[model samples]
Target: MVDDTLLETRHLTKEFAGFVAVNDVSLRVRRGTIHALIGPNGAGKTTVFNLLTRFLPATHGQILYRGEDITHARPAEVARRGLVRSFQISAVFPNLTVLENVRVALQRKLGTSFHFWQSERSLDALDERATELLAQVDLASHRELLAVELPYGRKRALELATTLALEPELLLLDEPTQGMGHEDVGRVTALIQRVARDRTVLMVEHNLSVVADLSHVITVLARGSVLAEGPYADISRDRQVLEAYIGSAEPEAAV
Candidate 1:
């Protein structure tokens, strides 16, 4: 059975100073599946993310979320439509405690006024929700710790928890496992898989093994155009994909 599409790009293109970064590329992400975008450095993976999230306006294209055109929607509007992205680098508030950071996210999700004089009791429910999110990311023990004090891997986990607080229907991750130890990578890989069970995920990942392990669909990009796309096994073995992106290395276990 064909899966329903949750997000899609039609002829998505981005150009700067007459140089195209992403060229007329169309992609679809199935609802409740993990879709991975892989390519060498400068293949325009990040550019595509920016376009989808409206961080960067498309040169010419349409972005559709749940079949509604949101081509020029603001980032927050897109997010409110159940599309949220986590950056490669951590975006946590360094001075805020882990629980506080999650609480802020929950408040945003709840659409509460940001006035300082708002009743503290109003946020109690948000705090409880935040605590539940921290537990999901395995950071319940560090809830009182400052965001900057946590180790890098834990920081990444916290970022995921914050994104989850948004209650996204489609999640975009940028190099989620970047700069992590092998064990940390494995842990994050598992977390991403668990999240994918509920929300559709689209990621720009450099780690071939992670893509192979998590992606139900793989789209290979080279020089701003799609080189190949299919199941991991087929795309990983395609001659053009290997020559243009994957190179000569044997596939490694997902980690």
Candidate 2:
């Protein structure tokens, strides 16, 4: 039988000077499942992401992708290995049209990322695949618009489109729905669901509604440690999760 785990962290820890941001956290993300890392303020959720992506070197621990230890992998190396991430803020180029932005991402796979000086016709081959990605995120009609002109929710969709252009095996999303009203939240949530159908996703999200809807497994962190781990059904009733995260209105707004 094949091993189903796609990503795993063992004894992961990160420190800043003398401050412990993430403390000995170990997690396993099974293949093709949506896993959410959630917590209240200062729970070290983003710190864990930084560690996983190799933005910060771990003080102690291990990061494993497909069962290989990757504790010291560089950010670019990690991304090249089929693990990609989207940010909390919109990351598309403001002046570029949605199609152009996605086409730029596709250029990475062709090994011509800095060839913008080339003829426009040279990159036209990517247009068809770019359009398919746009349609996947429901942004096909907005393909001609500059990314800056899109509404915030639509901008996020375009960013997702660009990320998909890289063909990631495991997508890491940081607060994908932050700062959105109910309508945009619903749209992005559905978009995440659609995109997650083919690959695995690990996200740090504050919105319980989105976490409840999409997460197959939920990990709760508190004070830089794992406080709970289980499905949403079990996590919802976890007394510690309720007291530390869900019971407070402010926590829902946390990043």
Candidate 3:
């Protein structure tokens, strides 16, 4: 059988001072799907994300992207392989305008990233593509404003736009909706849906509603191990998943 998985982790584990944070967790994120990693506080969700992006070295196991072991790869190497993580690599300059922030990412494709002496026309050439990326994240109208000038929620939107500029095949989002107001959450939820039409997304989100709405597969982590894995309907009713969330094993307590 052919492997449709875009990202896979095998026996992945992490430790800090002999305390295991992620224990033998394996994930299979298929192509063109939204996969959510969720759990209660201190379940090692972010640690798993850091491991996948190479921000933190795993104490054991393997990471496979496009069927190749990336266990020892550098952060830039993982990103260059088309597995990009938002907020880590997306350079959102506070002083630059929204469009300009995205233009910086686009400049890499033009091979003029380090050419400080490049002409204004060379940089301006990125404007059209940058504008399109802004449009993708519903930031077109705010393109002229400095990233710092935008409201908190729109600033996150700009970050999303800049990440999209890299044309990633697999996007890893760590709490894409954290610290947002209700309106901002809705808007970003919609934006995630829009951008995920073509590429796959592997996200660590705390918002169960957003996870239920966006994720094609959900992996529930508890005490540094996978408690359960399935659709939201199944995971939500799981006793173990419920106990991990609310400290009660009542199946109806809701995940």
Candidate 4:
């Protein structure tokens, strides 16, 4: 079947011991759109991401990617199918230069024979592509710095560049701007927007402005279930959503 939906979850549920983290939650992400998942703390947003990426097995339910059930797929299997995730913390090798980090990711995608044993000149073959990815993430100037030496925002950019090197069809971003200042947030937001031009992005983001600006669809989760789903304007005005945020006894900020 020619599926217009890039991703879907059917009655997805997750329970730890006797406690349910995600309870019969379902989602549909259309191809070529930025989808945002927003919620208060303990809302099971991270658990949903883990289930989709196969980091955690669902207590019950199914996950479909491009119409195929990925409920039992391995993390590597999902990633090979072009579903990649960028973590809240940067995922670059702290000791490696920004350029080298991207080069390594490109190598993983290429799977060259005896890749680790290949000469520096052979590895140089990936430099051009790595350079382009770095530029895309606005890390071109920091390409030579060790990943750990770069500023927090730039480290995130480098992680993004590495992820981009893999050319994922569906990108799962966890808090793309979690700890950034205003300037870095704007920079990362622009970078994400630019990258989503040709790919589908499903992001778990807290910043309402970023969510409102980038998402074509927004799904709000409260108490581990979908409370509302729509565009920013519609979801923003939802009475249930407003009440859910307001009712959070844990003092969470929500949009």
Which candidate wins on lDDT? 2
Q: After superposition, how far is residue 20 of candidate 1 from its true place, in Å?
A: 0.4
Cα displacement (Å) at residue 202, model 4:
0.1
Better of 1 and 4 by lDDT: 4
lDDT of 1 by residue, 161-226 (tens): 999999999999999999888988999999998878878999998888888889999998888998
1 or 3, which is superior by TM-score? 3
Residue 177's lDDT in candidate 2:
96
Per residue, candidate 4 scores C-alpha lDDT tens digits across 230-250 of: 999999889998987885544
The C-alpha stretches of model 2 lying farther than 4 A from their native spots are 246-255
Winner by lDDT between candidate 3 and candidate 1? 1
- Which stretches in model 3 have alpha-carbon errors above 4 Å? 88-91, 247-254
Task: Report the error of model 4 at residue 8, Å.
Answer: 0.4
So what's the TM-score on candidate 4?
Answer: 0.95
TM-score to native of every candidate shown: 0.93, 0.97, 0.94, 0.95
Cα misplacement distance, residue 59 of candidate 2 (Å): 0.4
Number of backbone clashes in candidate 1: 0
* CA-only RMSD, every prediction: 2.6, 1.7, 2.8, 1.9
Per-residue lDDT over 1-255 for candidate 2, one digit per residue giving the tens place of the 0 to 100 score: 988999999999988889999999999999999999999879999999989999899999999999998899899999999999999999999999999999999999999999768899999899999999999999999989999999999999999999999999999999999989999999999999999999999999989889999999999999899999999899888887777854556646332
Winner by lDDT between candidate 4 and candidate 3: 4
- Candidate number with greatest TM-score: 2
Candidate 2: worst-modelled 10 consecutive residues by lDDT = 246-255
Candidate 1: C-alpha lDDT: 0.88
